[model samples]
Target: MRTSRARFWAAVALAAATVPSGLACIWDGDTLAAEVRHRGYLVLDALTGRFDRLPPEYYRKRYELASERIAKDPSALAAYDNAAVACERLGRTDEAIDWMLKKQAAMEALPVHDRAARDDARYRFHANIGTFYAHRWVAGGAKRDDPDALAALDHLTKCMAINPEAHFGREVVQLGMIEWLNSERKQSLGDHLAERVMSSVPYAMDSSNNVLAEGLAGLVLLGAAWESVDVYNCMAHTLNFSFDSSLSFVAALRVEELLQSGKRPLDQSEGWRITLDDAASFWEDQYKKRYRTELTKVYSQLRAAGDEYVRKRNEYVLARLAEGRHPDSDGGFWSDWTEPARVELPDRRALTRSQFALVQTLLAGGILAGVVILILVASRVSRSRKRAR
Candidate 1:
């Protein structure tokens, strides 16, 4: 099925031309949160230093144990959270929201005297609810009046007061997402949010990241709408003007390797999915012709930065693919996570930094040996000449 090339490039032009207008800034408050976007691992990486996340079965057993704890004591707050995580992992997002709400009500009903001491708990509850509601809103078709939007905003607003100094408006990306969806991808939202979005955009994934921002950045660039040539073109513009150099692109690329090859964020759910046989093929052809060299340059620079940098890039790539984003087994370099082994790319050095150093050491040693041999030969020749004299 041939796609309308004219419609596709138009969206591409539009997406590329519009810039985020908000006064958003890179959030430096949470160091751990920053790395999550680049590597795609959180609790698992933090605890085991492994690049893997817990499997679905792990969530299942966790839910069972947490439920048993809850039955014995309804006030087992963490247990409610545990169960909610399990539900989310099982694709039961609404259920996850329910668990968080239950947790919220339980917190609300606490004695006023006890509430002061529970600010920490309240903060956690609001963040979790905001995430769940925003997620639900997306899954619910990203409608303008989705109750989830207001619910997310209500909870996130409550977040502003709990720790006024430390919170850092971490919801910047999440809120932009809600607003963007509500506006139906129009320029009006950008005009409204431009400053706010710019103030918090993470120029780099590892050092200054809001996974939410990083995640949403990728989300806006790609989604289920890509089959429309317009959407496909819009998605493939990895450096879509909205994000530009202040930050760059990928999750969609991995989603795109399923896409025509680009990435989106969050690493979950069918509502956010994109798959099209002809559209993907068309984008693939267009990408190879127009974007591959550019992507290769960005990708190569990161690879050259050293193993740690490459590791983070690989993690983001692998995490997106692992979520079942790829339509085919061949997801290129992103098909599997690289660990001690790094995948090679254009201009990627064949040696690690340490390996490069070792090579330099050996070459220097060889040169020194040659110099010594020349000196010895010169001295012997001089001695022979003297004896002849």
Candidate 2:
């Protein structure tokens, strides 16, 4: 009788422990579902610019709930990503870093074959961690001995080593820029680090045909700023094949600035000038072939705009020259010329009207052809079915 009573109590105790855990799991599942629903609403609000209408603590509450749920279920990777972003937006840098690190750990824990299969995801995860570290280093005033800065470099290097062909070209350029900036403060370490960072630039340029021109230009500017002739020359080589006239023009202007500042020697400047001029010419010819009628008008307008800006810049420089002063001596030359170049051309649309029209016509024609083919296939299938019957 005593033994039976003990058994009964033991079973009751087990049930009491197991029931609450089971119930807690169910509650967590429901909570996760609700959080997902709320996240969707928040995304919609942000996209529609209604996020401002939400209470200030709305994001904080969401983040807290997401973090809590993630702690209970680490497999909820999306929750981790969301919570990290929220922490970043809320200026909780340390927490953001911690969440991203957790995400990274989870990703890396996957089997090697599985990790290889999702190379893009792996690259992005590493790149994101690197970028966060880079930002943190900068936010901390770019201390020379900052561990975050070193970690940023390490992760960024890992990202490139994983897959140079991935769409992380911008990140590579950003890394180079960070290294260059830091090199100013810690000359020997910075220079060596900057060189290491710049090594990725060529990989970035060659890894993808769709490499961003702005990223390329930024790297070029960084090279110029650092007086790294090799870095800028590498960019010039890539830009030779890029065949982007506007980008070519802008790069040419930058090279000219470097030449004027005597940072780049005459021989290097000549090669860069020829390369950029050839790129401009090549793109112009291609544009002419593609849109014969619109080519003249578009080129003329772009040329006129470039001429006007150059004329104004030259006038500023000439005034400085008349004062027996070096154009950039007081750093006013940047405001006078370089800053203007950085301003996005107001009239620069991605596609000209004729190009837009051609794209639309092609799309419409393709859709019509697809519909006609579908109808023919359906009719043939129907006849086959009837014959079979």
Candidate 3:
């Protein structure tokens, strides 16, 4: 009997232990606290390179496990959110988006009062989506008008509207907006929007304080400002013979050439020198002085690329000019001059036109007056000669 009582008590202890696990900890308030703590720990681990403390490829495996767990539970939105955030840091944007979407769906299933955290998570997810779109747009140039970019823009805008700084959404939206403005064909709109983007840059940079993010922001601002210089050249009377866009374009082109040619800062200056005439010369100087050596290298490369692009464009322009074609306001060199060539009127036609008629009449009057004077002179001379004889 005593042995039976001992086994019963042991079984009760085991059941009590399992009760904590079986009671569905999803509704537990303490679960969120643990989740936050786990996130902090993961962040710490990532920072300290504590890979040994975590499993090999902990970020990847953890996300996978979290995804599996959420798939089974469907109510584990908090866990999924945490995993999605970690995935983002790991540069797994697609996986992150998936997890975030699940989190959003789970959040919507919850009550209004319980939705704040989930909504914030959604903001972050959308921001990353925007970033993905921006990168794609930059990569594809004129060809990135796909559904992904459109969806990214839509999500980012909604995220921004919900919470501007939520998950650093504003920066994502602003960066995407800058890319859009930069690629736009309308010069005036591009310039105005780019200026606004540059103006808001400091705020966005400060919000994240991410080095790469800030560096990109700086680069973008520099590009926009340089492009603005191009627009100024388009309208400036002083640059009628030499477009300012050429200067900017060349500066950017050289940077690109350097990057593509695998040339370094100390490489041969074969049409690759950063000269005073470069559109981003001043900006490059600032970077050289302000940034670290590595960062300076990146900035220099970007500057060179921008300059090289401009140079190639200018060379193309000069080539077209050799073919008697001209660079147009729409950023293209064309042989077709829209305006008609000037033509001079024939003397017969000149006699019929109003202004030409006036001139002709005056000329006729002058010739007649000359004839009368000559006749008078000859008659006077003839009379003088007869009297003398």
On lDDT, the candidate that comes out on top is: 2
- Superposed on all Cα atoms, model 3 deviates from the true structure by an RMSD in Å of 34.0
* Candidate 2 per-residue lDDT over residues 1-389, each given as its tens digit: 23322433333233222212110100111223333432322211111111112222433655766778678977665566567655655667688789778887876666565655567555656766676777678788888758998988888778778865333244555666567656543322212322443344332212122233333333322111234433343344334333333433333444444556777531222222334344345444555344323433444454455455546655665665556544212445335444233222222223443453344345446666777999999999999999999
**Model 3 over residues 153-251: C-alpha lDDT tens digits?**
676567656654332123533544444445443323222332333333333111112222222222222112222222222112111111222222333
lDDT winner, 1 or 3: 1
- TM-score-best of 1 and 2: 1
Candidate 1's residue-wise lDDT over 214-283, tens digit each? 3333232211122232222223222222232212233233344433433334322222333322222323
**Comparison by lDDT, 2 against 3, better one:** 2
Backbone clashes counted, model 2:
0
Give the lowest summed-lDDT range of ten residues in model 2. 21-30
Model 2, residue 35: what's the lDDT?
36
Winner on TM-score between 2 and 3 is: 2
Instruction: Flag clash pairs in model 2.
Output: none
Per-candidate clash tally: 33, 0, 21
